[model samples]
Target: MLAFIKRLLIGRPLKSAELGEQKINKTKALAILSSDALSSVAYGPEQILIVLITVGMAAFWYSIPIAIGVLFLLTALILSYRQIIYAYPHGGGAYVVSKTNLGVNPGLVAGGSLLVDYILTVAVSVSAGTDAITSAFPTLHDFNVEIAIMFVVFLTLLNLRGVTESASILAYPVYLFVLALFILIAVGIYNILTGEVPQTLHTPIGTPVAGISLFILLRAFASGSSALTGVEAISNAIPNFKQPAPVNAARTLMMMGGLLAILFSGIVTLAYFYGIVPKAEVTVVSQIAEETFGRNFMYFFIQGTTALILILAANTGYSAFPLLAVNLAKDKFIPRMFLVRGDRLGYSNGIIILGLASILLIVAFHAETEHLIPLYAVGVFVPFTLSQTGMMLKWLREKPDGWVPKFVINTTGALISFIVTMMFFLTKFSQVWSILIFLPIIVLIFHRIKKHYDAVGDQLRLTTCERSPDIKGNVMILPVAGITHVVENSLKYAKSLNPDQIIAVYVAFEREDERKFEEKWEKWQPDIRLVTLHSHYRSILGPLTKFVDTVAHKAKEGDYQVTVVIPQFIPKKGWHNILHNQSSLLIRAYLLYKRDIVITTVPYHLKK
Candidate 1:
């Protein structure tokens, strides 16, 4: 029944041979890989004004300049990642590049940064999308967090169904969003050129609440840098593309960068022209849409598409995080469980974990985009700087054809990215300090995991001089709860092992219980010896394990071994097993790692 439900939710188990069918082409890849960056424009422009407006409504004019700076950084990263696609087509993105050129520690840092950013991508995107919904229908304002988490859960399940299926599901809405934004941008530009577009929603205040300074400008720039967060995802997911993976991925990256540039710049420019303030209930984009098209079909259409693209933007994180995790797992830096694919061939564990983490952030921050934005770009920028720096080093060492141009581009990108990363850390240090603190801790954990895996590999390594130990004989010890069919079957199975001796051990809490048990054993007349342990304290496992240890100690001297055969009842109904005591399971858990003792379970199915 459970299997049927799993099949229904996740689809039928996909064969390994069906993996190639999951690779997506340019159109689908664009939607799946670039959704995060594309949808970020909905809030990225607003994040600038959100920070700038704190000084005064007049400082809102700085949004366009801040956005342009963000655009420059975006251009550098897009070009740098294009080179990364061709260079590391196998696709670990920043992690692979940093590790190969920079070293192991740097690679882990890049990997950790991208992983955290992916979580934020989902959280921030869905939260902003929820903001859009509330903007359209203010009645949903109070339940924003709930709505955001629901989208994350839905995306998680969709992603777990496999890549191609998700791409097909998410592609059309992304195109619709792009079309809507372009139309809005074009109409706004035309209206502005023709002279005078009225702002009816809210008027811009000229009061200066606080003085503007360089630090404040930098903070605003850092906040607006959220626009550049998902640019590296294309490079991170080169392998997810169809044939000619790198070329397809590079083309997609260029296309994504171009669209993002126009949409982001256009939106910010319109917001400035229309005097759209970042309101708690209405978003900057929503305000711009209303001012441009005014609460008509086009206005609600923009809102609906914005909400969808923003929610689907999490698909970018779902695509990259698992792939990065698989690389880390292969490198022995994380748990091997991440290396296992689900029934649908998706990275199920990584997808589920990303969803849960996103949901946690949404709930923690109450699905507020501004609060989550400060913690957003720092993660991506760190990897951005590292990836570019790593590429520069690669060009220097290899000095391949046209290395100079490549080196200059990467060097410039690295410098700009490093400056922005520092700006993010310094300007928003109060909000971002936790990430800085946790980053090194995460790297330290990666190193510790690597050391443990290395030690395990060494211990398990095969050697020429090693030989299997010879067993002369063995003893079977059965811990019986009562005179039942399970015990009878367990005894029969134990006899088949041809042991040196068979001992049935029972622990009794009271004298009366022990007497009754002994009489029942005597009446059965079994050939096996019965050992009764009396305990006034009513501790079964402690006494049984101690007795087993003594028996094992004696067996070692005789050049034999002890095996505990436990009888586990199989109830007709699955839940009925919970009604019975689990002494057999407890006994096995107690002696699981003892050197001279072996434990096994014999199941006895109940006919009724």
Candidate 2:
């Protein structure tokens, strides 16, 4: 029944040879991989306004410059990653690049940062998606965390089916979101050109508690930098693309960057011109959609698509995180369980881990996007800095054709990303210091895992082949309750081991039971010797344990090993197990502490 349910949900298991057939082409790849970056436009500009509105309405104009700065950084990242695609076609992303050029410790740092960032991507995206839903219905606001978790679970199950299947399932919603945004942008620009004023134009602007400062602007920029969080996913998962994976991945990266730049810039520009204020209930993007298309069919369409894309945006992390974990596991930086593939050829362990972590974050934060936004950008920029720095070093070491240009581009990106990373630390220290502290601790954990693997490798290393050591004597002892089919099965298995001697011992609580067993054994002529020991206290384990200890001690004197074989009964029904006494369990438990006595169990299944 469980296997049928699994097959029903995830489809039939594919062969290992089918993995290549699952590789996606560029069109589906863009939707699958770029959804996170593209979906950020739903809340990225809103994050900027959220930070700036803390100052006065006068400072809202700063969003344009801040967004342009973010756009500049986005461009640099796209170009830098294109170079990465060409250079490292095997798809390690920041971890591999940093390890190769910047050294092992830096590489582990990059891996840790990316790992945290991917988890947050899921949390933040799902929370924002739930927010979109609540904005439309308003009644479902109470169940935000539950809704977000459902989306996570849904995505997890879809991904477990297979990569290509997940991409196909998610591509339509992403395309819908893109179309909706473009329509919103076009209609919004037309309304502005025709001097059609929105009802929100008359809405009162928020007053600043204090004047705007450089610190406030920097904080806003850092917040808006959340837009760039998922940009590296395409580079990280280049292997999932079809043939010529690097070229397809790079093209997808450029397309994602372009879409993000246009959507983000348009939304921020419209919000600035339309004078949309940050509201407690509604998001800045929702407000812009209402002002552009009003509370009608188009408005709900935009809202619906926005919510869907945000929720499905987590697909980006689902696609990349498992692959990243598999790579880290290959390097012995994490547990080997992550390296195992599922029946459908997905990294099932990694997918489940990512889902559980995201659910925790959503529940802890109460599914509030604002609360999670502050913790978002730190993990992203750390890997960006390390990856670009590594790329710069690679160019210097390799000195390939056009190395100088690549070196300069990478250097600029490294500097910009480093500054942004430190800015995130300095500006949002109280809220984000946990990530900064977590990175080194995770790196230390990686080192510890590597140390453990190293030690195990040393212990298991084989130098030379030799013949197996011979035992001087081997004794097999079978403990029987009575003359039954279970005892016959045990004796047969014991004979297969070819022990030097076999003794079937029976503990008799009464003289009558012993005499009956002796008479039956003599009549059966079973060829094995039967020894009966009478117990005064009627304690089955006590006398049996002492006999095994004596046998073990006698065998140890002659460099011999003792094997104790016990027979276990299998009942058809689970409840039937309670009907029988579990003497075998007690005997095995008592014998477990003895060093030289080996215990084995042979099962006899009962049809009834």
Candidate 3:
């Protein structure tokens, strides 16, 4: 809990090898930044139809208006978030925006919302991809949940392999997706213009209501606006882009946003013109192709391309979520495990956490598009609303004269978004209230964390002498590694600690190690008492726990205080942790809980 809040914001949060520090090519950065927004285009229009279904299929064409409205919102969002990319090119994303402009409270809310939203990005894209696959292979229809979960797990492993590793893997699929989308749009537009409209277009029965109410319109807009959710990551991911960050990041955003907008608008228009309706029985894109091309080359190609792109879109979340978690852990809203890096300069813990959360979401909702959309949109909108508002606050605070255009753009974007946020809550209230419940919990958690940090800061503010309580008989217990010459090396440090008595303990995991150590003990003629215990369990922590408890209990025996000297070896890499000095941690935790026993570490370094 305490570790989460203590961040040295001065350096890169995770130190990188020259390998990890490798410059991101302009193309790859654009691909990573654009993939999320691009992949979202496939399902963005589908969301409108799903919401309209609640009103009944009769009014599905009404989705066209909603789709158009959503584009405006998306464009504004792109422009507004671009301000964020410019304002904070150092990365850390929404958390950075919130912290810099609004107070930490708002920043924390942004961070929390982004975390939830990022996982939903994975859940949404994977679930949507599962839908496409289920459509293509009807035999897999019933296994959407299983496939979605497996994909999440698969992605987790890919991410665990680390950032550059996963990025390299995703690059090809993303580029293919871009090309396929452009081809589909071009082909669809050409067919339409050349008077080759599909023969089998299924005409609708009736509009849900010939004249729709403002409420219904707003609901449809809320569903469609989910398309804009993935754009914020580019701003936050600026640090991952190559150096001279502001220019590179801004260009990436423009390329991503502009291409996504064109593709998205084209796809939406194509669906509408072709009378594509997303039925649980038949996916809209598949239906459109089958109607036009009669289950030939173009039909299957569209299906394959659509599915691949959606799958690649899920990868964006996998890439971004770990970076987001690291930022949150730095801020103290979550546990500190996020601070740890994997072998490839990746946040393995964050990746696992995101994977598990996405899997649970997929399982709980059974990867149903309609079921997941509400939860998904709510998570994303909260962050967008918060970040835009934060940007507005910044603009108002630092309204530089020459930057009037940006200030104008961001504030206008903020006002419209603020209204959109309130409207979505009202329109999506029933399906989205669960999100509202999470908001207060996040805020409360942040507040408690702040209190904890302040308290720790207060405690550590004392002078050096005052820092350690100068008790007359402060006994220290240290867990020994039982390695060669470690005991001999630890005794000197233990004596220097000014403890009453130091006992060197060993656990006999290997018979040879025990015999060799025993022979060394007798030959060295060391004055320190050597205690050895044999244990059968493979794990060292549990047995060490028992030994520490017994020793700590004995430490309260009058003037003869007991101090157990434990040796520790800290490793820089995760895989290098042989047993990870687990005995030391367990023994320290046990002794610290007991009265009159202080567990201390005697460090030993293995050859480099």
**Candidate No. with top TM-score:** 1
Model 2, range 1-608, lDDT digits (tens) per residue? Answer: 78899999889989999999889988899898999999999888988988887876777878888999999989999999999988888888999999999999999999998898889999999999999999998999999999999999999999999999999889999999999999998998898888896544532334343587888888888888888889989988988999989989999899998999999999988888788888877988899999887899999999999999999999999999998998899999999999998988999999999999999999998998887876777788888999999999888888998899889889988998888788878877887888867888999999999999988887666753433345797898889998789988988899888898898889999999999998898887468888888999999887888888898898888888899999998898878989988899889988888888889989999999
Candidate lDDT scores, in order, read 0.90, 0.88, 0.72
For candidate 1, what is the TM-score? 0.96
Candidate 2 regions exceeding 4 Å error are 198-210, 464-469, 477-484, 503-557, 573-599
TM-score of each: 0.96, 0.89, 0.77
Q: What's the CA error at residue 410 for candidate 3, in Å?
A: 2.1
lDDT of 2: 0.88
| Candidate 2 global TM-score | 0.89
lDDT of 3 by residue, 1-608 (tens): 23343232112344465544634656877666567788878777777776666765556667666766777777777787777777777677678887778888888778887788888888888888888888889999999888888888777777665555567777787877777667777888889888787634523434346545677767777777777778877777776677787778788877888888787787777776686767884677777667666778777877887786776677778767777777777777677788887655677788788889988888888788777767777677777777777777777777766566776666666665666677767876787787778877987887787678767767788753455423446455445554456555677787787766656666778878878887777666466666666678765666666876676566555444556566666565546777554655666666577655555677666664
Q: How many pairs collide in each candidate, listed in order? A: 0, 0, 10
Q: For candidate 1, lDDT tens digit of each residue in 374-443?
A: 7888888998899999999999999998899889889999998888788878877888899878899999
Judged by whole-model lDDT over C-alpha atoms, candidate 1 comes out at 0.90
Better of 2 and 3 by TM-score: 2
Candidate order by lDDT, decreasing, is: 1, 2, 3
- What TM-score number comes out for model 3? 0.77
